[model samples]
Target: MIMKAIQKYSVVLLLLFIAVSIAGCGNQKEESSAYSIFYINKDITKIVKQPYEPVADITDTNAMIDEFLGQLKTDPEDVEYKRVIPKDVTVLDYSVEGELLTLYFDKHYSSVEPVEEALVRAAIVRTMVQIDGVECLTFYVGDAPLSDQSGNPIGVMTNDSFIENPGEQINSIQTATLVLYFADEEGSGLIQETQEVHYSSNISMEKLVMEHLLEGPKSEHAKSAIPEGTKLMSVSVLEGVCYVSLDESFLNQDYNVEEPVVIYSIVNSLSEISTISKVQISVNGDTSGVYRDSFALDKIYERNLDYVDAEVQGNVIEEGATEELE
Candidate 1:
């Protein structure tokens, strides 16, 4: 009787051991699947949480654009900005048909001069492209790639939609960030651009010297030039050359010195940005014009320019205020 009981008990223990081994194997498989970082969730709604991180959309298109528009309506007394973005009144209808993000708008922008149109497009595209889940963008205004800001023919809902993949199902609530460059043709207010422009992608010894050592409040030469919040007008790059044109006040206000130092300071600062390449100076937005050519304004910089030495006319700070430090 005792031997028979022992045999049955041994069988039961063996079965229990096998069950435990299988359960351990199953857990290992689950752990391995969770280890991958690039898992594309078919249902993003199930995975994406409030305040998405890592793979979050770069710009909160809905919020930022609204704030940008609100800034325009601000009273003149409430602001001190140089150029407000001109509000464009073109159609801004956007929708997603599969992977292609279609933008429908009117041709109201082309009337605002080609250069203005180009600048506006660049700005909008850059901002939208910064968003996640956006790839190819198509523009259609009426029958063409130009139209009004809010009208489209295909669907009843004329607003935009964000598509996860370039050619996938359109996810509702995802506002199709319109890759618009310009506003309505008759947009009268400040014109806001949306482009990102860059100069030569190089670094050299001379470029290094002029670049870093030239900018900032403390320069070896010009003491009080280029005030804070000065708007950069234009930066032209040609064959490793960087010609920067800023507000005229950058030069006129920051100086009480001879021509050579002023020229040297500006040239060194910009040339340093590029690798020892030449730097050119222009007033307002022209290197050569009636104001430039007749007087040889470039040459006048070699003689009559005056720059104030920063060491002598340093900022007068009230004692114990710590304002400058702050």
Candidate 2:
């Protein structure tokens, strides 16, 4: 969500302003007095942090933000580290609401390569949220907010958003093969597809599964079982049951897909994981209510092949049972 726009200032003024405000925190002679300025390695493969000391102190919140952005756009003294912000990209405007800072950039920001863009984002977010009162940040291109390639909103990100090792390793890559379920062309039956994925090891397997599920199906005849614009808030597994928490948008089901189809689509896909035997879905973590007419958000669901089309099962479903299953 965007707020009122704030005027931009020169880098020097921003740095000076931040120095004065931060100096108020305590003694400037302390050895521990420094904040980490995140930068991309020269290879653009990972993000690294450099120590930065404030000269004075910062009293203004906007100045602190400007200072961090200025540091991000400026190249570090070490040639090994590169500036996170590309020359083509510029922060056109910005806004602040509570602890959330929203940066509105020019259209050029969208042109960044996906891999480098993620690194750049990690650097920016890791640096900005360091401000005393700012806890999270989000991005906007012109009037539109940023969305992942899958079209889900990136939403608010904090230090916990990016996985970083204790010392340096950040945004490390890992691979996994997933068996995901999607809706058929009719949007009334479940179809299973096996997919190989290369992702950040920083992300958990369950979260990765949900991300791919939200991205929709890659098969020609398959369709997405989940609702468009549904945001996965959180997901985890405990005692063989995977608990999937999503935003309220999940409640806005598309009419083309049946309720049970949508429900089992998640249930079966998550159950594909060896550790997950059952699945429980909740809206914003509140399972007190039901989904639609008969499906309960609090209910624990087990994989049911009954909804799988008989064509793929080769007569596993008894004749004329498809209608009954739906």
Candidate 3:
């Protein structure tokens, strides 16, 4: 009787150990499960997030990208989002370096319609950058780098690159009023105008204001200080100073305008941002250059109210001058 009882106890112990081992294996598998990020278009203007789908566990980054792209070709299991990548396009190869990921695609990438280009690019960029350790992305189609409309190389793009505005998806957009300074019709002083702007969440407010200023003013009485055809290379803020980089065309001026008027127009306009205290201008990324023959471009500029034509009680008047009776 004792021998039979001992045999039953050993069998029970072995069953318990086997059950524990099976549970541990199951947990490990669950922890190794992978997820793929997808971008869904919001209102045809912006890209928004969708729930990530679980993918087959893969260790290699290239293989992981392949699986993600393959999944993107098919309709997502969840109905809330639709696939943006064209089925004809295929990923030729990819490489990962530090924080940047480069994707090489076949000729089908260029075959995407012009109207759908932005949407497709946004979708791909937004999806890939979400992965850990990937901060920027570059694209190549058949050994040729992607270029923008102006033929400028679209270099490494971060999450803030493609989206005009980055923020929560709201039903309506919010706008802010801006006081911009422009060259007066007479070309003697700066004219102040109030502009209503739709604030962009993806871009810095100062950059948006500079872009609008570059577009020139709508009012017939004011003129743009920035020369026509001048391209904005980049805009960035470091510490309290806002740095604006422009192309060579900024030096070309058809009308006779003072250096101060042109320089202060940008300085004062950008200084309206609460965080910015000064403005620095650069040409083609070079800070040391001459803007015409008058002002040295290397120096930082502060806001000068003397050049601005101030507004008084709904009437426009020259600074330090009283309104004369009409």
Candidate 4:
């Protein structure tokens, strides 16, 4: 009877040990998951996070990077999102120092077309920066740094480097000197103001100047020539001519300002850029209309300083003229 009781107790203990071992294995599997992956969208314009069970031990930066790059080579159909990296491109290696992550790829990385090159870099940089502790990124093919179509170094990139509009890669802060034209307090003539503006590279200087013109003048002596609520549809410079397209609000005559002042305000301001010699104004991309009765919107105009306020300078010149006559 004593032997039978001991044997029964031993059987119970073995069964309990087996059950606990299975539970331990389950817990270990759950704890290994640590990360998720991101991939580029179909347009090659944006990054999309992949839906997957968290990866295990992603704290290893090198292994994490390798896994991310490996996903980029997956077929679009095989994955939920499209991959931006060309299949021919391979990651040579990667290194991390503080917040900066440097990625070296094979020569195929630079072989992308000029237009797609920026997009590729944007997709890669954007996806990589999503990782924790990665604040800046740089790309290289072998020992040489990657460059854009214009041969400018791709440079270190941050989260703000890629802009949605224009899809261009630029620094977060770029300084430009803009010569803007606004109306005088009396609304009789235009006034020229030189301002130093800091803007993102993703935006063109012409667009920035147009936006500032709509914001009105900082000085109390100057006023806005653009009508209130005027929407700038687009602004671009090509072959030394700047094209400015505005919404219907620009046609409203409620401002009580002369048509030429409004017309020349845009013309002179955009023409200030050395590359833009003239400006063509349009309403909603239609250049067939006219402003008031005399100013033709269909025609391109050069910078006209005739409507500018020259009273102060005129007074100085008049005083000199009087002295000369005397």
lDDT of 3 by residue, 1-326 (tens): 99897544433221110000100111111133344455455334444555565454765666666666676667665565666677788778888877667888899987775435555666776676556556666788898876544443454555555434334431223468888888877666788877997643334566567768987986676899888887665565656787777778888875566778889989999998888898888876577767877677778888997977554312444422353443
Clash count, candidate 1: 48
Candidate 2 lDDT over 1-326, as tens digits, reads: 12222111111111110000100111112245478899999997688888886546775889888888888889789999899999999999889877768999999998987767878888897787667767667789888877666455565566655655564334444569998888887877888877898665556567778888998987776789999888876565666888787779999969899888899999999998999998999876578888888998768899997898757434323432664687
lDDT of 4 at 55: 65
Per-residue lDDT of candidate 4, residues 1-326 (tens digit)? 99897544433221110000100111111232343445655554445555544266666666666666666666555454666777788888889977678989888876765434555666666556556666667788879877543233444555444445444422234568888888877777887776787665555567678777887876666788888888665565656877677778888884567778888989999888889998888776678867878888879899999999897335444665797899
Please, what are the lDDT tens digits per residue for candidate 1 over residues 1-326?
99887544432221110000100111112222111111112232211111112223425544433333233222223222211223453445666443234555566544643223322332333233323333334455456643222121111111111112343322211211111111111211111111122212111222223222223333121242233343333343445555444445544433233334445454444433324365555554455542211433343222111332322223222321465467
Estimate TM-scores for all models: 0.28, 0.63, 0.61, 0.49
Instruction: Give candidate 2's total backbone clashes.
Output: 11
Best by lDDT: 2
Candidate 3: misplaced stretches above 4 Å?
Answer: 1-36, 41-75, 88-119, 130-134, 137-156, 161-171, 186-188, 198-204, 238-240, 253-255, 284-288, 294-300, 309-326
**Distance (Å) between predicted and true CA of 97, model 1?**
33
Worst 10 residues of 3 by lDDT: 16-25
TM-score of 3: 0.61
The C-alpha lDDT values of all candidates are: 0.31, 0.73, 0.64, 0.65
Question: How far out, in Å, is residue 107 in model 3?
Answer: 8.2
